[model samples]
Target: MIFLAIRYLIERKRQTLLTFLGVFLGTMAYVAVSGFFLGFHVFIVEQLVNNAAQIHIQARKDYLSAHQLDQAFYENSYRHVFWYFPPSGNLGYLEVQDPQSWYERLARDPRVEAYSPLLTTAALFSLSKISVSAVLIGCNPIQQQKVTSIADYVVDGHFRDLAVGGNRVILGDELMKRLGVGINQTVRVSVGTGNASPFKVVGRYYTGNRFADSQAYAAINDVQRLNGTPNQVNEIGVRLKDYRQAAAIATNWSRIAPERTESWDQQNANILSVFRIQDALRFSMIATVVIVAGFGIYNVLNMTVNQKRQDIAILRSMGYDTFDVVMLFFSQGLILGVLGGACGLFAGYFFCRYLQTIPFMPAAPGNPQGYLHISLDSAIYIQAALVALISSSLASILPARAAGRLTPIDIIRAGG
Candidate 1:
């Protein structure tokens, strides 16, 4: 039956080629689009994961109530206090409760790969007469490097230089450019209108992200002193054994620690929402292509069945069962599917390779002349082939079943 179907398809060369082309194009389009979108997804995720900690723990907040205000008023009553307007206060430190305890817990949790305590403060970076406001992040370079990929993005100087605590700072590449300073240059850094101290430029990193670039890092002790908060850390950044387990771990950790804990995904929920939409769009586009290809397969097979009515009738009368008749036409669709899928896979692979060679710079400042990312994930190809095959099989079924039910008497009467 398979041989007969192949011979029949071969005889109608134009129809067979056209059907094959439809499936071929559909499969190739699916693979190419999947590679591009999925590849971009991987790149975005890598940036998020590397630039941001999977789990971020920050100082817990406190609020002043009317009772506290009443108490303060009573205490200061002797001082002739009238209407009260209390001053704003800073949040308490995560380390204030117990730094050693947190570290011990982090160490005991085998899932924790690395963690870093941070003290972030706002600072004005001035070079001679030019000054720009920038975020100053204080971290233990040795620990920070382990927690995040800040070390990997370093283009100049060493992250470890910050550990020396010589008022040295590592600036982001964009920040360095804005300050108009280079390696070994001196810049005065003042924490939020505090005393300005000259910092020797020890290192620079380029994350290609503007926000990340608009930051500088110094030793944790330097930042603590600058912030006037000794023996305090406001934040703890953590990387886990499996980053995907971040949300769950963060939720549980927040319950144990007196700090606000958030996973990278939780922090960037809006971005993940956009990703879900993109995924839907990607799949919908491929499905549309495959469905159109299915219709093309149906049209061709429908016509083939109509034209081969006599053949069906004769075969049925000559001892071929109804199952054999169905198998014959079904095999034709399978053959087209196999041939088209094979060709499409090869074409898609080459197209994706070509796409990978093309350069694309992000609209935001970062790596210029970066090659386009293309994921040749095997699953994409497998999915492409499966969709093609399933579409072909379904489109062939109606015509195959109709051919199987054809009667020799009806064919003879129609001929007569």
Candidate 2:
């Protein structure tokens, strides 16, 4: 019966081949589209993790000004030999007194890890004898170095240079490029305190993140001296020994330091929300492609059954059961699915590799990075194949059922 089925399929080779091609192309489209979307989403996640700390803490109840408006706490000493404790502050709550002592006590918890107190004051920079306003960052170099990539972010000179009392500063490559300033060039910073102050440009750095790289870094004490707020810092950047503990640490800090602490998720809520929305959109697109491809499979299988009606009837007369004929046709669908799925896997991998060589693409709105890297996973292939199989089988089902219902007498009458 199998030999007869093969011969029947061979006699109608053009129709059979066309049917297989249709199914194969549809499967390929579905797999390729799904793979691209999945790969794109993984790329965005990786870029986000690389650009910013997995977990960030800031003052709650403060919107855009969480980093600047809150009265954060600070500790005079490092919590541990490795940890440099920063100040803490409240946003909605009345400024708490003795926050320094409060943070110190909290640091004693075993769950606590390395943390740094920080303050951020938005200021503008103007090169001496030049007219350009650039953003200025005033942070504790000692602690900022431990938390942010400012230390490793440096391209020339050291972050420690900003720690000195002499109004020294570090500039980003982009900022310097715009200002036409180089290392050792003098630049004046007008921080809206009273008057513009002068600081010597001593170093340059790049963080790869466009926003971070488009600013200047100054000493925390220099900002303090200008603001006339002694021993006051605005922000604290915390680093956990185990990043996986971020949620736990956030919950602990929220319980202990209520109304003050905010995690990175909360800090960057707008951007994170955008990521989520884009993820949904990508998934929807992939699903739509798969559904359309499933329809193509249905069309192909329907044609196959029509072209082989006589053959199916003859097989039934030769003692081959309806179940056997159904299985035989279903095998064709399975073969097309397997072959197409394999082709799609290779196509997706090479397509991603080709994308990398091109310039960075503009991602969802507010995502400043121009390009992203695609991530490939083994599970994606499995998912692609599974989808292909299900679609193919479903497409073949109606045709198989139609042929199964055929009577030998009806077929013989039609031949007469």
Candidate 3:
């Protein structure tokens, strides 16, 4: 039966080749598209993961409710004292009240790999005659390096240079460009009408993010002095042993701790949503192509069954059972699927390699020349092969069944 199926397919070479092409192209397309989108998705996710801390803890602020306000102001002297507008906003400086306690707690927790206490301040940086407004983040160099990938991005000097702590600063590439300053140059930094303090630029880093590149880093003590809030930290960045557990840990910390805690994904939910949309689009596009390919297979096999009705009837007269006839035609579909899918895998691999060679740069400042991130993951090829085999098998079923049900007597009567 298998030998007969092979002979039948070989006789109609043109239709068979066209059907094979359809399955081949469909599988190849699926592999290539999946590789491209999934590669990019992984790249973005890695950036989000490594560029910053897994969890952020902000300074705590307490607000008074209306009932509490009434109790404090009226002292229960009057029954009702309603105002046109309710009171709002917290009272106190925006500095963490007890950062030392948090430091001790995080150090003792096994889940926390490292944590950095930061005092962020908006300041004006001036060099010679140029001035730029950027954020100045104060951190301990060693702890900051452990909490984020800042050390990897340092281009001019070592990140540990700031640890000298004598008013040293590390400027971002873009921020240094804006101020027209270089390493070892002195820059004047001032916060909120205070006296401008001179900080020597010791290093420079480039993160490829425009906003991030427009920032600077300094020692925590220097920043506190410059901002006129000595020994105060406004935020704490925490890196977890297992980043995937960040959300749950952050939620638990927020409920128990005075400071506000948020996971990395929670901070960048918008970007994650865009990734989800890209996934849906990638699958839908490949699905459409595969469905079209399936139709091509169905048409070719259906035509073959019609044209070979006499041969099928002759086999039936020779006592070929319905099951045997069905198996013969089904074998043709299986052969096409297996061969086409194999060829498609090779083609897809070469195509992905070609894609990687094409030069492309993301729309980010300070980014170096690079190619597209195309992933040749094994799962992509496996999925492509499965799609091809299943679609082809399903397409062949109806025609195979139709051929099986055809009676030798019916064909003879029609011929007469």
What do the candidate models score in CA lDDT, each in turn? Answer: 0.85, 0.63, 0.87
How good is model 2 by TM-score?
0.73
| TM-score for predicted model 3 compared with the true structure | 0.90
lDDT of 3 at 173: 91
Q: Which ranges in model 2 have alpha carbons more than 4 Å from their true place?
A: 1-40, 53-55, 59-114, 124-127, 130-135, 140-146, 150-153, 160-166, 177-179, 188-198, 207-211, 240-252, 284-289, 361-372, 405-416
Ranking 1 against 2 by lDDT, winner: 1
Best candidate according to lDDT: 3
Give the clashing pairs for model 1: 208-366
Local error of candidate 3 at residue 353 (angstroms): 0.9
Give the range of the ten consecutive residues with the poorest summed lDDT in model 1. Answer: 87-96
What is the Cα-based lDDT of residue 180 in candidate 2? Answer: 86
What's each prediction's TM-score? 0.90, 0.73, 0.90
Candidate 3: minimum summed lDDT over ten consecutive residues — where?
361-370
| lDDT tens digits by residue: candidate 2, 1-416 | 44554555566667556555554555455445545566676665544543455455444454333223222233443232232333244335323334486467547856545555544566677765665665665677786665555576677999888888688888888888888888897877775778877789899987666777777778877866766666665555666566556666676766766445655555556766775675686466446535655565556556767777787777788897888877777666555556655666666667666655555775422334554454566676666667667766776677767777777787777772
Model 3 Cα lDDT, one tens digit per residue, 150-211: 99899889999999999999999999988999999999999876789999999999887889
Residue 366, model 3, lDDT: 27
